[model samples]
Target: MTTPAPLRFRRNDWLELGLAALAEQGPAGLTIEALCRRAGKTKGSFYAHFPAIEAYLSALAGHWRETFTLRLMQEADRGEAPRDRLLALDRMALALDGRIEQGMRRLAQLDAGVAATCAAVDRERIAYLEKLHGESRCFAPAEARALARIEYAAFIGFQQLDLGLSPQELHDCYGTFMRLVYPPSFRSGPRV
Candidate 1:
């Protein structure tokens, strides 16, 4: 008989799977059996990875935060201009809207642990943005702080709108908002 290919999996496999499911279906759909089935792993594997369902969900939130930070920083690194850099950060937030709307935010609403993890992620993003703003000669320290808060809030509001715009459209809308909020020096080039 032909031997089956060896199954290779890591301890965190289910946690990753759980996050994806949560992103797709929300916390209500993240039952243990659902995750195992979605992951193509056994219940034993889930048990081996997490002591309980709550433990797995907590791990999933941490995973989401790490992933969000990495993506934002990567985008921020790509722009040569500070204004462009901030716009890039806004793009990252737009990219996250679908995942956030699908389930993660709702999950946080019901679970304090999940909410704290999500808040931690938001705090980290804001702190990073604040540092970027402070470093830019384009704006005074107070202005930078205020701009960061405005940009952050605007991005969140756009995401909540579920307007279903393409990424380019989202960026353009944000760019327009930035122009109205910041001095001319801080306006990025046309956001096409």
Candidate 2:
């Protein structure tokens, strides 16, 4: 099979290559040699930026956190209303790169550093959801927190577990989930 075409790699280029490698083959596939081949570079180039594989992995996790989690959270917070915000979150969830998500999650299982970072990401997302549910629904804090946990769990399960869903189907499922979790007042009609 034809490999990725030849390309020049710069400082951030390694991070891009790491992400693509993580997406395609999980963390196990991210190596200096593999990335060098994929980017048509050399060990000299890789070492120029990363002193060792651990450093590269650290950078990879940081890149994913900045690009994916933080960006998605910003996108989801753009709306004024709770429904709008939650839908924005659903849209972001639906748009996540499952391959990268799965790869990172698997890495978390085997690597302590990755696991801590992944846990932090999860905690941030769950906290955001919890606050949204608590504020919008005015549920008891415990109930709202539970709802948030459920929502995030479902998102992780759907994406990482290889649930067979066409894009449209997953979209519908997420929409349905959001609707189900909406506050009763919000669901009936206009916000009360």
lDDT for predicted candidate 1 compared with the true structure: 0.72
**TM-score of every model?**
0.82, 0.89
Best prediction by TM-score: 2
CA shift of 120, model 1, Å: 1.2
Score each candidate by Cα lDDT.
0.72, 0.79
Regions of candidate 1 where Cα sits further than 4 Å from its true position: 1-6, 78-81, 188-192
lDDT of 1 by residue, 1-192 (tens): 111212765656665666667666778668988876676767887788789988977988887777667667876878887667776777676676466444777898988998998788777777777778887776788887787777777666666677888887877787677667667766635763
What TM-score does structure 2 among the candidates reach?
Answer: 0.89
Clashes of 2: 0
lDDT tens digits, residues 48-106, model 2?
88899888888888888877788877887788876677777777777777889889988
